[model samples]
Target: MSAVTAPQADRAAPARTASDDLDVVPLRHWGRWVAALLVGLVAASFLLSLARNPNLDWTTVGTYLTKDFVIRGVGITLLLTALAMVIGTVGGVLVAVMRLSANPVLSWSAWLFVWFFRGTPLLVQIIFWGFLAALYERIQIGVPFTGWHLVDLDTNAVVTPIVAAVLALGLNEMAYAAEIVRGGILSVEDGQDDAATALGLTRAQTMRTIVLPQAMRVIVPPMGNETITMLKSTALVSVIGGRDLLTAVQSVYAQNFKVIPLLVVAAMWYLALTSVLSLGQYFLERRFGRGRRGSAGPGVISRWFKVSAAEGVAR
Candidate 1:
C-alpha cells in the first residue's frame, strides 16, 4: 500500500454573529388592519347617524333613562333575574343530583321535570304560570288525597304577575341549569369518586367537597351564559304584564310615541348590564382556571397582544 493521505479537510468555518441568534420578526397580518378599519368606519358612521338623526330623539332616551318608573323597572328586572337564578340554581343542583342518583324514581322524576320544562317554550311557560289561577282556583298544602289541609290559599292571590314571572323564569331556568350541572358532573372521572370513597367520604360530602369544586371549572362559564340569557329573557315577562325594563319602556313609548328612543334606552341598559355580567364571568373563569396549564392570565385582549408580539419576534 502506498503511503497516501487525503488532503486535509477545510478547517475554517463561517464566523458567528449575534444576528444568527436573533429572532426574525413576522409580518403583521393585513386582514387585521383591514377589519379594524372597516369596524371603526361602521361604528363612526352609526354614531354620526345617531347624533344627526332627529327621529332618534336622543333627548327622550336620556330623559326616560333615569325616570323613576324606568329605574323601578330596572330594579324589578334585576330582582327577578337574581331571584330566578338563585331558585333555578338551587333547584337545578338538586335535580342534577337526582338525575345522577341510583334510584330510578328520583332520576325519572328529575328527568320528567327537565323534559317538560325544556321541551316547552319559555314564553308559553310564563303565560301558563300567569294564568295558573284559572287552572287551579286554590292551592292547599296537606297530605295528598287526605282532604285535610294545613294551608289553603287562593291561587289568584298567590300567583301575582311578578310571582308568576319568577316561578316561570326559575322553573324554566332549572331545566337548563340541570343539564349544565349534569354535564359538569359527568366531566369528572369515575376514579375521582372511587378515590373519594376510599377516603371514607359520604356521597354528599364527596360531591360538595371534592366533585363540585372541580366541576365548577366546567359549570361556571355556562352558568354565566345562562344568567345573561335569563336577563334578556326577562323581557318576555312583558307578555304576562310583568313590569320589567321592557315593560317600562313600552309604557313610556305607548304615550309619547317615541318608540325608537325608548327602545334605544332599553337596549343601552341591557348592553350595560350584560357587559357587567361578562366582566364578572371573566373573573370567575379566571379564578376557577387557576393551577391549570395555560389557564391563569389576564383577558384574551392582553394575551393576544403578547402572543402577536412573540410571533412577530420569532418570525
Candidate 2:
C-alpha cells in the first residue's frame, strides 16, 4: 500500500523542466507614461503659443534673414571666429608647454599672461584695443633705446577696428584655452610620460606622438564648447564697430525701426550657424573617441544605413 501510494504521488507531481522554472512576468512602468504625456502637453502648448503670436513679425524676419549686408556680416563673423580660434589655440598650446617647463622665466611669464588676461573683463580689453592709438602714437621695432629703427608702424593706421577686434578676442581666448590645454595634459597618466621616456623618445616626440593624442580625448569636448562660445562672443565685436551679425541687424533696425524683427532675424541666423557647428562637433568627438571603452555606438552614417536596411527588410 505504501509503494502504490508513493508511485501515485510521483506520477501526480511531474519533474520540472527549464521552461517551467522560468518566470515570465512583464515589467510595468506607469510613471514613464505619465512623464511622457506631461512633456508632450507642454510642448504642444509652446507650439500653439508660437503659432498664435502676432508680434513676432515673421515677414520682416524673413525679409532681412538673407539680406546682402547681413550675409556679409555673417561672413565677417565666421572669418573672425576662425582666425581668433586658430591664433588662440596655437598660443595656448605654447603657453601650456611654457607653464609646464622647468625654466622659471618661462613659467612665470606664462602665469602672468594667464592671470592678467583672465582677471580682466573681455569688454574692457576690446575697448582698450579700440582706443590703443590714444595710448601709443607709434610702434617702432628696433634695438631698445637705440636710434636705429628696423620698422615703424603708425598706431592709427595699423590697428583698425577689425584688427583690434581680432587681437582682443584672440588674446583673451588664449588665456582660457591655455587652462583647458593644461588641464587636458595633466589628466594624462604620469606613467605614459615615463613609458615614453623609457622607450628613448625625446620630450617633443613623446608629447607630439603619445601625450597629445591621448589628451585630445579629454580636450575635444571643452574645445567644442569654446568654439560655440566664441561664435556668440563675436557679437561683442559690435561694441568696437567691427560689423558682426548683431551689428548688421542693429544697423538695419536703426533705419527702419523694426527692432524686434531685425533682432529675431539675427537670432535665427545665429541658431542656424550654431546648429551646423554643433553637428560638426558631434562628428569630431566621435572620430577622436574611436577604440575607447564604452564609446562604441552607431555613428551618424551607421544609424542612417541601419534605418535604410530596416526599411528594405520590411519591404
Most accurate candidate by lDDT: 1
Would you give me the overall lDDT of model 2? 0.91
Candidate number achieving the greatest TM-score relative to the actual structure? 2
The CA lDDT at 218 in model 1 is 92
| RMSD (CA, Å), each prediction | 6.6, 5.4
- Model 1 residue 313 lDDT score: 100
In order, the Cα lDDT scores of the candidates are: 0.94, 0.91
Q: Output the worst ten-in-a-row residue range by lDDT, candidate 1.
A: 3-12
Clashing pairs in 1: 24-315
Clashes of each: 1, 0
**Candidate 2 per-residue C-alpha lDDT over 1-315 given as tens digits, one digit per residue, 9 for 90 to 100:** 335587788889978899987999989899999999999999999988876778777888888889999999999899989989998899998999899999999999999999999999988999999999999999878988878889899998999989999999999999999999999899999999999999999999998999888999888889898989898899998998898999899887889899988988888888999999999899888888899887748877899999999999999
Error of 2 at 97 (Å): 0.6
Model 1, range 24-69, lDDT digits (tens) per residue?
Answer: 9999999999999999999999999889999999888888888999
